[model samples]
Target: MLKVQEIRELIKLIDQSTIDEFTYEHEGEKIKMKKQILTAQAQTTLVQAPVETSPPALQKNTAQVEIQPGAQQHTEVAAPQVEEQRGENLAEVKSPMVGTFYHASSPDAEPFVKVGSKISADSTVCIVEAMKLFNEIEAEVSGEIMEILVKDGQLVEYGQPLFLVKE
Candidate 1:
């Protein structure tokens, strides 16, 4: 376990650094933290509620999504098991492989996507550099990007949620 002061200092360091997210594993405790600016559009999604009246109504409403490259967005759908819970409609874009996630192709390149960016189905949203090779990731769903869960050049594990999109 980390002391409050230690956690505060870590957050301060992360705030001052150029990176957007930070993670460190010590002993059996794994801590992963991300710093997202929470753009205006993303803020709106938080307060919005899903229009869920029936089971079939939920799936029918989330049929179409559009994603674009360098500004890809993700959509949120209520989990099947959690349908009984009210007001949870968010989609997540997951990292396909295990490696370091890069927002851009290189250090000097612009980030592939950011909060409020639009993405399409074939758009290359980000890249995961592993074993000296860079693998481009695409947006499987199309929607307005609500949040960025990881920082550029951060080490991400497989199946991690990289972005959250509003559906």
Candidate 2:
């Protein structure tokens, strides 16, 4: 639980620092923040970006988008590696609502599951906190968790993939 002033202070500190990203944790709360230095070209050329899917912020997934002068702008994202790696058989566990993701009931508790952990359809995999409500998320598909997509205390969007399960 970070105070608003604390967060503002962090933003100021990070802005002044040379680092582009920073992560801090204290008393069961974890926060990861990043700042991007966009050129005028990049800013003016970005396609319609979803607030939930800030593709450019991923950096690794960024593609070189070139727009000819006076031409129309269009969306052209590189195929996500997750899609390529998950293949056709993987099932994604998606968030039911927009919220902050938590890996365990408590920060000190063991995470519900990890990569390679087997799960039943009803097994609790994580929790999503929305509007002060903590909702336990179940692994709807019985399988092994191949990947955990969201980080602890990270904001998640409705229908966003949280885990990849192999059934």
Candidate 3:
């Protein structure tokens, strides 16, 4: 079994390097770590094989590690793509997590922010539901909502632009 500090070090290394995934197997232990660009996080799965088993079979055990946005140096590469898709004057409100996008707090309520709506840095423009958790996404920039890039109930990945604003 790998120690917590060792696992942390591995995650740090993976976060700094360009490798998106890493796996290791030795004796009865196996470890797998995969980096997800959208959320700037990494998930690790560890499997231990029973000594008595004729053929080693993996046991279900998993752990997840989240690297902060600052640790994701590769995200800078995607900035140019977004700039190319959107004009220089437009600011994008991106999804911070991979989940279903909802325009309003509930289906019966009016949408949080619509086209032509003015928003400030703290404005809650939409909700992103991931693993049954509803997270209110803020605009993070003051601007007028110029476009809604995604539809309600649509699945959106991390870093996907949900709305375009003219700042």
TM-scores, each model vs. reference: 0.48, 0.51, 0.55
Candidate order, lDDT descending: 2, 3, 1
Please give the distance, in angstroms, between residue 163's alpha carbon in candidate 3 and its true position after superposition.
Answer: 0.3
Model 3, C-alpha of 51: deviation from truth (Å): 32
Q: What local distance difference test score does each model get? A: 0.57, 0.63, 0.63
| Tens-digit per-residue lDDT, 1-167, candidate 3 | 55543554454455456776777666655556665444432222323311111111231222223222222211111211222135877888887765799999988999999999999999999999976889999898888999999999998764577999998
Steric overlap count per candidate: 11, 0, 0
Candidate 3 residue pairs in backbone clash: none
| Highest TM-score against the true fold, candidate | 3
Model 2: per-residue Cα lDDT over 18-116, one tens digit each = 666676666655556565544322222345322113332232322222222234323232212222225777888887666799999998999999999
User: What is the Cα root-mean-square deviation between model 1 and the actual structure?
Assistant: 17.5
The C-alpha stretches of model 1 lying farther than 4 A from their native spots are: 1-88
**Higher-ranked by TM-score: 1 or 2:** 2
Ranking by TM-score: 3, 2, 1
Clashing residue pairs, backbone N/CA/C < 3 A, model 2: none
- For model 3 the local lDDT of residue 128 reads 95
64: Cα error in model 3, Å: 15
